[model samples]
Target: MTSIQVADQTFVAAAPELAADVVGDRASWRRWWPDLRLEVVEDRGAQGVRWKVSGPLTGTMEIWCEAVLDGFVLHYFLHAEPVAAPPAEPRELTRVLADSNKALRVAGKVMSFEVKDRLERGRAVGAPATARSGTA
Candidate 1:
């Protein structure tokens, strides 16, 4: 079986709970594999989530999403054999790996941004409004 591994880390300027929600939900997870159908296999709080994805490429991808008190990290491992023999050229393999890494990085950034926005909105709503000087 062929294997691929990729990892990315992001610092969320938000609380751990907010960051965890973005990384743990099904809707958010689907964004990573827009072309594939991903079903949640397991979701344990503060630990990880596993997903079974099937499409033109069929396999299970387990994403161990952990949230430290400071930030969040995602580690992914993909295992599958090509439907047909892969091109023998080394460049072909390299290209495939690079593309996969790029996709993961993009996904991580989106998740982090969403969490930060959510936290900022929550904070704004909770804070008291300040009166303008001499305007009232």
Candidate 2:
């Protein structure tokens, strides 16, 4: 297992295709993961994207859009280790993992929430899906 492993899922009351549009933007990848350079490993259309990542860390990352009742359950994962040599001390590795965990978690939430809010527009909590897209 990598020293830093992060997995996050968010339920967005928006259709899978809509979510895919935002998450699959190649240009936006720079903004979403500024520290990592991502090369497409798989482009799964409405399903999502998998990337071979390299930069501060090296490994695979993915955003999977799962169709649920009303919308997509976005699953985000990052399994990577530092690109540099492994830290010599366990304490240093732990600290790095903790910090990376926070930063990555926040980044994932921001992306998911952006799509949720934009697509769902003024949807009240517990409101029914109202996206006008044909699939919705």
Candidate 3:
């Protein structure tokens, strides 16, 4: 019964804990999802957070930070349905769903890229990378 679902992963050249800090910012949440209200369902610290979304949509959203080569992969997931009644006609429903899907998709990408741009300022593109975990 989900009308819109966005699953995105963006790699950032920064520590997981650092990325978590950026993702956990309350002000940024309001800025990124002004139309939606999010209440924390779970706080995973350096990993990320799960939120119960309301307002424009009703469902669950999460950002999972997975440690990767020299950085972390920020996974954004938004599973929601339109708050208003969906179109009755098939064609209208398709159009509405597509538009909503695209909008949410773009929003997720923009948010992740902003984080990447902010934290990976000087990282060289195409550089060979390896995950930094445990002790050497």
Residues 2-107 of candidate 1: C-alpha lDDT, one tens digit per residue:
4344444544334344434555777766665676677778775444567676664556666554655444454555554334355689999778766755665566
How well is each residue in 1-136 modelled by candidate 2, as lDDT tens digits? 7777889998888767777677888877888788899999999988899999899988999999999997889899999888777567999878878998789889888877776777788778888875746743
- List runs of model 2 lying over 4 Å from the truth: 132-136
What's the CA RMSD for each of the models? 7.8, 1.9, 3.2
RMSD of 1: 7.8
Question: Cα lDDT of all candidates, in order?
Answer: 0.54, 0.83, 0.84
Between prediction 1 and prediction 2, the one with superior TM-score is: 2
Error of 1 at 100 (Å): 3.2
User: What's model 2's lDDT at 81?
Assistant: 81
TM-score list, all predictions: 0.58, 0.89, 0.88
Error of 1 at 92 (Å): 2.7
Provide the lowest-lDDT 10-residue window in model 3: 127-136
Runs of candidate 3 with Cα error greater than 4 angstroms are 126-136
- In terms of lDDT, the best-performing candidate is 3
Better structure of 1 and 3 per lDDT: 3
| TM-score, structure 1 vs. true | 0.58
